[model samples]
Target chain A: MPYVNIKVTKENGGLTKEEKLTLIKGVTNLLAETLNKNPASTVVVIDEIDMDNYGLGAEQISDRRKAGK
Target chain B: MPYVNIKVTKENGGLTKEEKLTLIKGVTNLLAETLNKNPASTVVVIDEIDMDNYGLGAEQISDRRKAGK
Candidate 1:
């Protein structure tokens, strides 16, 4: 079984349910096509993190957003 | 920098905020101790999946739970 986790910052109120489903399906299919993995046993989890919890370049995402950079 | 994604089943109403915080801290510390990683740049994401979305041994977690297994 292949487990995949996709983490995206919670921007614009996060992703919609349909978008999440699309990501799960697309990732599973890609793994099967490229790595010869079994789609039935593949697991894809999407994590929507708050901007305050995510950091980049020694700065929190929330702060970056506030600065518009 | 190290990125860690933790996947856990959303059972019994999922984990409390304190528990999640503990996991983030513990994982970060473990990485720092074992791999000399920088905790300040480490990213840890926790995913709580629904039983219905998780599968094992060709059976969904929801089904296994219903069967009391």
Candidate 2:
């Protein structure tokens, strides 16, 4: 029931509408504390991209280098 | 980049080893088509959960419901 679909990038230029509702309430509190679930049946979807359209295995990266790049 | 995290009800018996990978690929294709991005640049995440653990707007539901219900 917890639906979280987050595709990040956009060179950090996106996420403006209240930071996309605070990133779907911070990924619904990190998937309700890592899977315990119950943050009102968390359903978070944040898809934003631009940085070369995003990649990893083939090279390109974002989300700040997939949290590291 | 495209990183999709899908959390569905475990009630579906949860996807198996190959199913998870297939899902990621499916979502990647969807995002690529919808957003006009390269498939290689897409990163998808699928998180499965119990039905009772997810809710939408104070009402519990599943992907089936979210899609229409």
Candidate 3:
């Protein structure tokens, strides 16, 4: 089984349950269609991290947002 | 930046903060040393999913656990 994990920043109230379910189903379908993996056995996990906890390009997302870049 | 998301089952008590940090640091170091990616630019997100929400081998982890196989 393949476990897919999606990470998104907890900004703008984060994703609703419907959005998460959509991602889960969409990703499951993609894997099943391309990799031939069984959709019934695939798992999808979504993580909503705080901007301060996620960094990229030597700066945190929170800082990047503050800079408006 | 490379974002690494790890998924684990929340069967017992969830991972301790120390365990999470260890994983984050270890994975970051591995990526930095192997792929030459900047450690500061890497993001590691850990997700602990409920057994009912995670499936493998066409069965939910909760079910598998209950089966004791």
Model 1 per-residue lDDT tens digits across residues B1-69: 998777888899887665666777788888889998998888877777899999998998989999999
What tier of docking accuracy does candidate 2 attain?
A: acceptable
Worst 10 residues of 2 chain A by lDDT: A27-36
lDDT of 3 by residue, A19-43 (tens): 9999999999999999999999999
- How does residue B47 of candidate 3 score in lDDT? 69
DockQ, every prediction: 0.10, 0.27, 0.18
Quote the lDDT for A63 in model 1: 65
What's model 3's TM-score? 0.55
TM-score of each: 0.57, 0.47, 0.55
List lDDT for all candidates, in order: 0.81, 0.63, 0.80
Any runs in candidate 3 off by more than 4 Å, and if so which?
B2-41, B44-69
Tens digits of per-residue lDDT, candidate 3, B1-69, equal 688777889878777655666677788888888999988778876667899999999999999999994
C-alpha root-mean-square deviation, each candidate:
7.4, 9.8, 8.1
- Candidate 1 per-residue lDDT over residues A1-69, each given as its tens digit: 799988898999889999999999999999999999999999998878866555443445666688998
| Runs with alpha carbons beyond 4 Å of true place in candidate 1 | A1-6, A15-47, A50-69
Clashing pairs in 1: none
